[model samples]
Target chain A: MLLKVKNLNAGYGFLNVLWDVSLNIGKGEFVALIGPNGAGKSTVMKSISGLLPPKSGTITFDGQVINNQDCAVNCRSGLSYISEELNLFTGMTILENLEMGAQMLEDKNKARENLDFVFELFPRLEERISQYAGTLSGGERKMLAIARGLMSNPTMVLVDEPSLGLAPQVTDEVFNALRLLNRQGLTILLVEQNVTKTLKFSSRAYILEKGKVVLEGPSSELITNDHVRKIYLGT
Target chain B: MNNSRSIKAVEWLKSSGGITVTCTILVALAVSIHKGPYVLVNTLVTGGMWALMAIGVSLLFGVMNISNFAHGEYFMIGSLTAYYIMHPLKEYLLETPNSFLAFITPVLGIAGATLAGVIAGILTDKLIFAQLRKRNREGWLLNCFLITIGLSIILINLHMLIFGNTFKGVVNYWDVPSLALGDVYVSVDRVVVFFIAMLAILFFWYLMMYTTLGKKIRAVAQDENGARMVGIPVNRVYSTTFALACGFAALAGGSLLFMFPSYPTVGIAPLYNSWFIIILVGFGNVAGAVPGGFMIALFQVVTRTYMGEGWENVIPMFLISAILIFKPYGIFETKVRSVWEQ
Candidate 1:
């Protein structure tokens, strides 16, 4: 397994979100965690990425125990998290935002190469390279945020609710980009509210309800399961 | 494409060109009034020093989102260090058979001041600011403000106790006889101070614009949580930024000491003056601090020279207040707030 969470429990002050949530992802695999709002999807992502301190349990990434590592250390270890809220440095230009993503890398040439790759992935970002991230359209900002995460060339990517505020067409565009990246051998853990779309893209799925995983299996199998279909798919 | 191109052009004009034009016009006016090269040089030099302090204060606010009330204490400490060093060194260097030591005294004074500034920065962080950071409370700023005010009072009193509250001028040894350029007399110290201040500002500019550390600092300033998520070490950046700003402020203090005399309470005027410059330059725009410093310094010099000392006090107060009312973001704009939001 590339990443494993054993009975992970976490939350904000006085409010517990995750309780004994155990999950795992294999190397280069695409996994999805889908649930309704307040299902602890974001809290899981935050705990794994070291944004919030986990109350209990272990998070092991690539053979190293990483339960208590800070965000910077986790990022350096090749785990990147893109939060639902627009976290792009709004004051910075698209190019500058990408540059910041590649801040930990020492080689300028490597950074330049990554920048080229990111621009190619999102042509709109290339066109708006000098434009402030704040001024970008909602769809474009989401693309920029994802593009920034890609710049770091992480071992695994944890993307939270990419479809949150995007239109259906834009959502398709973002998912397609993620699909292409996963196909190119990047491990991905996609957290989303769009059940149909997430299951369509991911190989494995975990159904989270109120901080605990109620069901977990191959995405194809779970999509057809009566419980998942009724509870999540509105079948 | 055409519509986007036009929008981009408009933004470029709105953001960069307007500020540049205003600064140029003001500089030209100052030059025109003082036809003598020395007078112009002196004004520019003094302006650069004031700008350094303003830039330091602005950067602290930008990154930490906290007002550092103890910033002026950094300046005072720097000048005091220089004063202490010069007091004992002047006798030894003057008595030395060689004149070289005398020539090098000012450099040593600056070095001493820089060291003192670094120490003061570390202490401020470790003793006071760090505690606030841990509390996860916003009240640290208010606490720091009150603490600094109290610290300043104690510092001045301590200065009175130890240094006897007497003004001490940094002794000059270059004796290069002032260069006579028509009506203005230019001294070597003024010329040296100008170049030093310019170099310091340029160095800071390069660091903020081009270096990795600079990028990290800017990231934290823009969004602390976002920066940390991206793996930037926020605490290390904060402490280093504080030290860097204090170092710049100290350099300014040292330059001021070279140009004038120092007393325990002498830092009060420059501290007040820098507060005006900080606002006039915009809260977080370091680039604006340079011109803002010069603008205020020129106002002081010109008013003092032409309209007498009485106008020196009146003009800065009026100009700063007027500018704040009209352009609260300052002469140079910063990203701390959106223009549309305002």
Candidate 2:
């Protein structure tokens, strides 16, 4: 396993959000974590990405325990987190935002290489590089956010609700991009709301509710499971 | 492309950059009609110091959510640093006019004053603010303000104990005579002070725009969590930023020593001036402080000329109060770098 979590218990200062939650992801696996609002899906991503410290249990990434490590340390150690809020420096230009993303890439040559890759990943971003991010269209901003996450060229990417507040067509375009990245051998742990689309492409899926993992299995098997069909898929 | 370009142009006019250009033209026009070169130079000198001090307050508030009432003390520290070092070296230089020590003493004092402010700022952050940052951040803004208040009181009393109420100062740093510009004589000291202030501001601009640490500070300023996600060390950035802010305050204090003098309560007027500029800009932006400081200094000069010397602080306060009541976001623009900014 490239990432492992065991009985993780965490929350926001006395408000226990995650309860003994345990999960794993092998290298290069496309995994989906889906749940209702306030089901601790985002919290799980926050803890694993080291944005929120885990009160108990352990998170080991690439064979090293990474529990309670600073977020920057996690990013430096090959982990990139694209948050739901899409924290792109709105006051700054698209080019500057991308440059900030590559700040930790120690090797200037690799950072330059990644810059080319990012511009290529989203040609729209390249064209509008000089424009302030706040001026970008919704779809372009989402693309910029994802492109920023890729600037580090991380080993694993944890993307939380990349489709939030996006149109269905734009959402499809985003999912396609994610699918393309996953195909190129990037380990992806996605927390998404669109369950059917997520389960269809993700190799494995974890169903969380009330801050605990209630069900976990292969995506293909879980998609047909009666409990998931009733509560989540509305089939 | 033209459409987008126009949009960007419009955005620029709304930004701090646009405001600066507009204010410069207006001030220049007003100068051509009424104010002479001497008045212009005076405004610039006073304005430059205020800009340096106000920039620190604005950046600290915008980034760390700190309302540092104690910021004035850093200014005092600079004054003290320059006074102690410059006095003896200056005396020796005056006795022996051709000596190298006299030629370099002012520069050394200036450098020492800024360095002292930075050290004091960093130590304060590491010893006090760093401890508070580790705990829960609820009411964090209020807590920080209170702590600064306590710090201001403690520092002021400490200054009284050590330095007493002595008004230690210099008439000027260099012995060079004032230069005449269009029948108006401009003091060499004021010219030198303005030059240093501009240099410091430009250096600050370069640091914020170009350096890696500056990028981190800007990132953290915009969004701390976002910066952390990109692997920027937020805590260290905070400490460095605080030091930078204090360093500027110190620089301002040392540079303006000839005008303000060094005393226990000397910082009080400077503190008020900084707040006036901060409020006038009506934003949490460092860039706005430059023009805003100049604008306030001009207002002071005008009020001083008409109503004698005492109304300098009084009228500005009343005007600001009126502005706060009517257009609270700020008079120049309704910019949102407010401490209460969500």
lDDT score of residue A66 within candidate 2: 97
Q: For candidate 1, lDDT tens digit of each residue in B205-235?
A: 8998788888889888877767877778888
Measured by lDDT, the strongest candidate is 2
- TM-scores of chain A, one for each prediction: 0.98, 0.97
lDDT of 2 by residue, A19-90 (tens): 999999999999999999999999999999998999999999999999979999999998999988888888
For DockQ, the strongest prediction is 2
Clashing pairs in 2: none
Alpha-carbon runs more than 4 Å astray in model 1 = A107-109, B1-42, B150-164, B305-311, B333-342
What DockQ, on C-alphas, does every prediction get?
0.61, 0.75
For every model shown, what is its TM-score relative to the native structure? 0.88, 0.94
Q: CA lDDT of each candidate?
A: 0.81, 0.87
In the range B127-195, model 2's lDDT, one tens digit per residue, is 999999888777888899899989988888899999897898987887777788767788888888899
Of candidate 2 chain B, the 10-residue stretch with the lowest lDDT total is B333-342
What are the RMSD figures for all models against the true structure? Answer: 3.9, 2.7
